[model samples]
Target: MDLELYQVDAFADTVFSGNPAAVIPLYEWLSDDLMQNIAMENNLSETAFFVRKGEYFELRWFTPESEVDLCGHATLASAHVLYEHLDYDDPVVVFETKSGRLFVDRENGFYSMDFPAWPFHEIQVTERVAAALGARPDKLYMGHRDMMAVFENEAQVRELKPDFRLVAKVDGLCIICTAPGLDYDFVSRFFTPDVSIPEDPVTGSAHCMLVPYWAKRLGKSQLTAFQASARGGVLKCEDLGDRVKLSGQAVTYMKGMIVL
Candidate 1:
């Protein structure tokens, strides 16, 4: 079989800047093991697979090692492939995912993703977390897949060096370190060795927690966010009552065929 694949750099206007995701559109769903092997072969942070199901496409995400419940950059990258490569004309694309229905819209030069708000609750910082992070957090919270840590400022967020092996033992998807940004509303970094990504350059799901948190803190509905990973990415965020809107640009880096 021959499979078409698209490589997209999400949350970036240019290639080689934002997080890269492999988007594979299939006629039918591949087996779990095969999808895992594809993702492992791609070796990106996440590989997105989608198939048409009625009016909406059913989407799934996998890392190099395992599958994940939610992923932002890959979702955006998939939408990009549908619109730019597959010649999808619609401005809005809806996807049925494990979490639920997700909507992506294209406007101007940016792609906006409507994702659910996954607000976390505050928690007491444990010594294990403190040790792994190499510093104590001012505040901490727990969410479905990761722990949230609030830092003093963006400088601290940029300077953080966590022990990934130790962090893998703490549980959840990964740890999020965030602080108020000097230029943007906030800055963040995502670490998830458990999912086989040591660090994600730009994370859309992480903003689900950040949008609401900063909205309450900064008292604004719309905000800007920067991920401090080596590749880096910038996101425009909006806090809807029940959901959050994450907007960013994506560029096509490569396209080819996978023969099996």
Candidate 2:
């Protein structure tokens, strides 16, 4: 059989800049092993698969190694596929995911994603954490899905060269390093060597944790953020009571058939 596959650069207006995700538009759910294998074969940070369900859709995300609870870039890429490739005419598309209901809307030329915020709390920085990061952060925190390390400035966030082997031993699925940005309100970098992603170019999910922290610290509900990965990308962030809004642009990089 042949499956439709699309590679999209999420949170980027142009190709090859933002996070790249593989999107498979499925009419029916495929087996877990099959999807996982496909994701592994695709070898992107995340591969998103969606099956249409009435006006909304059911979405799942997989890395090369395992399935994740939530993923921001792949979700944006999926929405991009639905709107741009599948001829979806709606301005807003809702998705049922492992994390719960998610909504993506088209506003102007950008795609705005509404995601559930992961509440995080400050944690004591340990020797192991400091060793893994190479540079010790000023503060450390843990969220529902990731551990955050706050640095003094953007230079600290950008200059990081983490020990991936040691970072994999950390308690969380991923580590988020962030600091105040010069161009944007805040800047961040995400590392998930445990799950095979050394660094994510643009992470929307990490911003769920970043947005709340920065909003409370900066005393603002709306903010701008940049992910300082090798292939950097921009994100517009907003903090709501129990949710966060992350807006960015996506473009299709490639489309082809996957034979199985």
Q: TM-score, each model?
A: 0.98, 0.99
lDDT of 2 by residue, 1-260 (tens): 89999999999988889999999999999999999999999999999999999989999999999999999999999999998998999979999999999999998879999998889888999999999999999999999779999999999889898999999999899999999999999999999999999998999999889999999999999999999998999999999969999999999999999998
Model 2 spans > 4 angstroms off? none
How many backbone clashes can be found in candidate 2?
A: 0
Clashing pairs in 1: 145-173
Per-residue lDDT, model 1, residue 93, is 95
User: Per-residue lDDT for 1-260 in model 1, tens only?
Assistant: 99999999999998999999999999999999999999999999999999988778999999999898899999999999999988898868999999899999999989999999996899998999988888888999998877999999998889888998898888577899999999999999998888788889999999889899999999999999999999999999999967999999999999999999
* Prediction 2 global C-alpha lDDT: 0.94
Instruction: Determine the C-alpha RMSD for candidate 2 after optimal superposition of all C-alphas.
Output: 0.6
Which whole-number lDDT from 0 to 100 does residue 4 have in model 1?
97
